[model samples]
Target: MTGTAFDLPLEVLRARQNVKWRKYAPDVLPAWVAEMDFSVAYPIRRAIERTVREQDYGYPQRNGQNAELLLAQAFADRMQDRFGWTADPALVQPLADLVQGTFAALWAFADANDGIILQIPAYPPFHSSIAETGRRLVPHRMHSDGSRHTLDTAALEGLVDARTRVILLCNPQNPTGRMFSRAELLEIGRIAIARDLVIVSDEIHADLVYDGRRHIPIASLSPEIAARTVTITSPTKSFNIPGLRCGVMHFGDAALLARFRARVPGHMLGAPGIIGIDATVAAWAESQPWLDRVLVQLHANRARLDAFLAIELPQVKWHQPEATYLGWLDCSALRLPGTAFDFFHNKARIAFSPGEAFDPACKDFVRINFATSTAILDQILDRMATAVRALG
Candidate 1:
């Protein structure tokens, strides 16, 4: 009823058979992944449909400006509107996805043995990329006091030694959903500048911020910070088009941009798919109204979860995320028979992203995806509460 596409009936959503719906059996509710359980924005859908109807699946081509450049322009415009940050379209590099951009940035900037600083409880791909690329992972673990999570700048400063080459930042961080404030980013920026470190900021969740919080690009703070930062972002996550595989990496330094371009082969860093490009353009250029509606639903769902847990499962502690549809529940007090993931899977018949996936030290936690219809979210909470009670 929010005039958002998220009101799609459960049957309609299930029929599509996306990863969010098909990953688990009919009996199990899938709330493990980052994808939203919502309908596509009408503008995005229309763009895709138009492209298909015209059978225009050829390689994307643009005069003067390539597809990526055009996307960058749209991205820059959106950033200016949404976050009050001015970005140059020329600084935007189109990539297949943010993960590829992160890996490429790490590979291009650091050697096999050099260290790359990551905020622990990070997106899992960061861990894999560092290991697979043979780079040392220096974790700056965030401190959580059960109410809120704080960035450990002192710990980060200590971790920055001669071997540290790059710092990866995830704004509106995944799993925990902690959106770093401008002041916090400024402090981190100071550290990076002092150490002359390359900062690859993954702000894919920039648009998903809640509670009147504005997402400030760490690179957008100052000239010195921009000079050392590479921003990896996309319309895919917020617009529900990840499978379309469209993402962009933004830079303010010419030399750093050149290095990334030189190391990553053009073919490997392929152009955005026709569908993705169309969707990206539509999502960025015309889908703000739809996005606003979706956000309203997401915020309401978050509040509902907070209330539900307070009554049904008081032992499960959580800090309401400032952004993102993820609920990082502290299940340590429950003392479940096994890992939170296992107990939820075997007993609760609900699938949640395991805390261990974010950080090894987070075995007692679990990340729940709350971006779903209220009816379904209520069902998930009811089932989880039943499972917890059954444990006793």
Candidate 2:
């Protein structure tokens, strides 16, 4: 049970049966996707079954998402109790996914070709969302001092211009799995407020914090800071419900939320996928027991991976993440022949998002998802070790 509560196996998993049922030959460990391998919790399954039996896949009701939103609300209370970080559900709005909400929120405050500040080693989509909209992406690089990664605050301040209007941030960050503490977030929030900049915080992994680390929401740092923050949160990461397409865009600024609504007001809420919502709602409202179990096992898996790297693949360094399941493996020691992404894919047959995707300066680094069964992660590490050995 690995001290995670329910005593599930050290490498327990239940997933990708879809590939088998479809008659496809599988060679990949299938760790690329963010989805977890656990079975859908019982309440969610029951809800979806009832919905399907009633044939209720239809447009979102005009009354807003009070019934469905209740789960997130309850979950917030539960999280506050567990972690001491509280949020007001009144500030939260239902959305399709975090990226869409991020883009929509960015659209509300910035213009085409207007500068958007993004800290390096971020969620890759944050970079793309800015460029795809023709906005200038100003990268505020972070420094990796071998043992730990730290933000370059001076470099960030230097990049700001009158046109630089927004900063996109990831907490319990994607790829690197960093959960910024309250002091760190305060410094960041302080920067935004001083620059009169709006902040877009992608907090999908808020619930997946590991060990004793806490995820301090940038908005909740202070009243002034809160007024300038737009936090995108969901159970998609915690409960492995990304397929659900249900998320919340929390705004401390009513005027800002109104602006976002104006931008997407007439836009369709689209059809609600009953299964996804049920799973998401159940995860937030009633699946705390299951969540505790998952976190417990996750820590064991993380420890095992760390030990393996320390002994078997010392060329690539990794940290024990305080939150999230992604690992940023420092491959600078390997000095591979090409980019980290190409090197890993061509040599290892394992596809990880290249550092270039998140931060171009991080040319020697690669991001891997550790959110899989220990057995599969072991296979990946074995292949990874072999690939690194080939480089030597």
Candidate 3:
């Protein structure tokens, strides 16, 4: 309780009921899920506390000084200040979460059986979102050159067809952790524009880039891209508040916003709770210092994991992530008896996200979440080493 946000004791984390901690048995170390093991930023906690204390729970209002408008303004201001993307507060709308935003976007834009082009080994929910919305998933696998991953724009070009209506993009991409460069984004934008497709960009990890690399919003590349883009982002990932369920979808202009609203009814996308809205406002407007501290811990953790893999478990392969706490590890070289996730879970007692969940072809991969304390991370790595060595 007294240490840095990321250094919470295992017992302390286990006491919580969040899925990250409770999804598996207590004996299983969870290096899976995207949730971080950091304490809530003080500002966000204070905002939630104030909302509860004041008994402010009510229907969210969109007018002046209400939760909705404040959230919109805060998000717009954060976009401008952080990424130089001038977002319109009027076009910002809230949703229960990014997945909901994605579903709504697909429902509003693409018809059933239409295709959505998505990079493979993507965030698992993206696959589900496409399926749930009755859209075909056109998988575009990223290229990995042993050191890093890059967009396969050339391969991407062939995947699009007349039926493709949307290009779902994830920046600071999940699992692999590659932050698509501006030039890469421009190419994607060009394709979307030429193909007459909408681009739904998931940018929840924009604030978590490391090594001083900045995240570029794909829609920011050009007016044409923006007009065709629907940006979905939230403070949950960077601020470690997923349970709050607050996310925003920004349409480029009134016309684009109107197109969406006309199809997806407002009532279907219920507003976030009063606490969620207030916590989000505090996260965007007043939690940079806390985020900076968390990032420092995450940076150290990433390096530690990289060194541990290289020295202690050299058979494992991965691309050092430019952003986010997730590590996409390729355990194919180890020739484990089963899938990497199963081997780790059964032998190491550490649960990782199975790569097959992201893409069927990545069965040899397992995504590890390294956002815990140094002590816990060391334990996780040590267990992994022991598990791998036991095979010998």
Colliding pairs, model 2: 1-7, 4-296
Cα-based TM-score, every candidate: 0.96, 0.87, 0.97
Off by over 4 Å in 2: 1-25, 58-86, 266-272
Better of 1 and 3 by lDDT: 3
Best prediction by lDDT: 3
Q: After the best TM-score superposition of candidate 1, give how far the Cα of residue 111 lies from its true spot, in angstroms.
A: 0.8
| Model 1 weakest lDDT span, ten residues long | 1-10
Which clashing pairs does model 3 show? none
Clashes of 1: 0
lDDT tens string, model 2, 1-392?
12322332323432334421123224444445566656656676676688789887674332366355564575467557755656677666767667878777777778998889887777878888898878888877666666657766667778889899898888877777767777778878888889999999888888888776667778777888878888888787787667767777778767766776787662544423556656667777777777777887788788988999999988888877778877888888887778887777777777666777778777788877776656666778888888888766
Candidate 2: minimum summed lDDT over ten consecutive residues — where? 16-25
Q: How accurate locally, in lDDT, is each candidate? A: 0.86, 0.72, 0.90
lDDT of 1 by residue, 1-392 (tens): 33344676777777875787788887788898888888888899998898789887767654555566678888899889888888888878888778988988899889988999999888899998899899999988887876788898878889998989999899989877899988889988999899989999999998998878888999889989999999999987888888999988888677778877788765676667768877898999999999989999999999999999998899999999988888888899998767898889888889999999889988888899998888888889988999999878
lDDT of 3 by residue, 41-123 (tens): 99998988876787866675545566788888999999988999998889988888889999899999899999999988999
What C-alpha RMSD separates each model from the true structure? Answer: 1.7, 3.7, 1.6
Worst 10-residue lDDT window, candidate 3: 1-10
**Best candidate, TM-score-wise?**
3
